[model samples]
Target: MKVLIKLFATFRNERFKQEEKELPEGTTIRQVVAQLEIAEEALGMVMVNGRHAPLESQLHEGDTLALFPLVGGG
Candidate 1:
């Protein structure tokens, strides 16, 4: 399956702020993280298809995925 990924914040800077990516079928968010070679800690906030999702969330074809570093500060 193909999944569209949006990166934000420091994670974006590290990953070159890729707008989209195609993932394999049955790939989980964790897997995507690894595939993209993102730092483990960079798998911060996750949204799948516009809904909050966990790292274990499985990706589906045409799914829109967004990821950002853990938001901090006041």
Candidate 2:
């Protein structure tokens, strides 16, 4: 299955802004994140095709996955 991945905020540092990836069928959001070397606790939000999804959410072909890192502000 092919999916588009988008990284936001600090997650983009030393990483790509977005890219298309060919993942195995039944790949979960957590699996992709792990593959990217991103810690689960470091994520602030996860989205699939613009809808909020959980880490255990399974990805589908042509799905758009977006990842946001935890942010801190005054």
Candidate 3:
């Protein structure tokens, strides 16, 4: 299956704004992020189709996945 990924903020700096990734059926969000080498601390929030999703959320073909990095402040 093909998944569309969008990286925001720092993540965008590391990865491109939009990317296409291939995965077998039943790939979870966690697995994809790990496969992409995204740091755990860098993962602030996960959004699937514009809604918040957990790491265990199963990915569907042609789904738009967006990941935002954690923004720290004093």
Q: Estimate each model's TM-score.
A: 0.79, 0.96, 0.90
Worst 10 residues of 2 by lDDT: 7-16
Candidate order (lDDT):
2, 3, 1
Per-residue lDDT for 1-74 in model 2, tens only? 99999999888999999999999999999999999999998999899999999999999999999999888889
In candidate 3, where is summed lDDT lowest over 10 consecutive residues? 6-15
Q: lDDT of each prediction vs. the true structure? A: 0.78, 0.95, 0.90
For model 1, residues 22-72, the per-residue Cα lDDT tens digits are 666788988877877887785667898888988888888889888777777
- Candidate 3 residue-wise lDDT, 2-39, digit = tens: 99999988887656999988889999999988987898
Instruction: Find the candidate with the highest TM-score and give its number.
Output: 2
Best by lDDT: 2
Alpha carbon lDDT at 12, candidate 3:
73
Q: Name the TM-score of candidate 3.
A: 0.90
Task: Give model 1's clash tally.
Answer: 1
